[model samples]
Target: MTSATRIATLVAALGAAVALGGAAHAAQGEGVSEVSVSGHLPTQVTVPLAGKDRTVVRHEVRLAAGFVCRNAVTNRDLEFSDLNWCSQRSRVRAMRRYDGMVARGMLTAEAPVIVLSAR
Candidate 1:
């Protein structure tokens, strides 16, 4: 994907993360162990390239609630990572998923790391 497209995607993902994080915070004491997020992950993604666009069908990724690492400074920076979500474990799972997303290019390599604690 082009740099612009990557940045845009990163920004949107972070926006969702922030909103969800707030909700998670509010609902922390409700004994909610798991969360599900859908619609964001698509089977096919249209990526813009040089004067043209291409479509890529990503493999099925199970949805689960996990921690998201976003740029601590700002969302304008295309540097962040997130775990799509899954079974509730703890910080260990969140950290693992965070690294996994970064490896998958779902999050930027240089994005500042801020892992929201599991509630």
Candidate 2:
């Protein structure tokens, strides 16, 4: 095969592999029910000139069928702080925690509203 043809074939194969992998991953969570959870939590963040500060932010938790957050506090209003989930470290941890919950049938879907403790 020509170089161009070989490259195209390889790209197609890779695309197919990725599609299959995604399908498999999605299928693994099929038939699961999720709950709409909302709450707020306190997260520390650094201000440009104000240094470090603690803020209460709103977050949503979309939990899958069988998973649950033992420490999840829901239905709380975002009155404490005016910020959403901020800070890279805190955000990553929150995402990982949410992903873990979803993986174990806990949650899915996230948005900025109310509060859902992802800590």
lDDT of 2 at 56: 23
TM-score, model 2 to reference: 0.30
In candidate 1 the C-alpha lDDT for residue 95 amounts to 47
**Cα lDDT, model 1, residue 34:** 78
**Candidate 2 lDDT over residue span 14-47, tens digit each:** 9999999999999988977998864543322221
TM-score of each: 0.24, 0.30
Give, for candidate 2, the lowest lDDT window spanning 10 residues: 58-67
Q: For residues 6-106, could you state the per-residue lDDT of candidate 1 as single tens digits?
A: 99999999999999999989898688677776433222212212221111111111121221222211232223332222123333454465457646765
Displacement of the residue 67 alpha carbon in candidate 1, Å: 43
| Cα RMSDs, all models | 25.6, 18.7
Off by over 4 Å in 1: 29-119
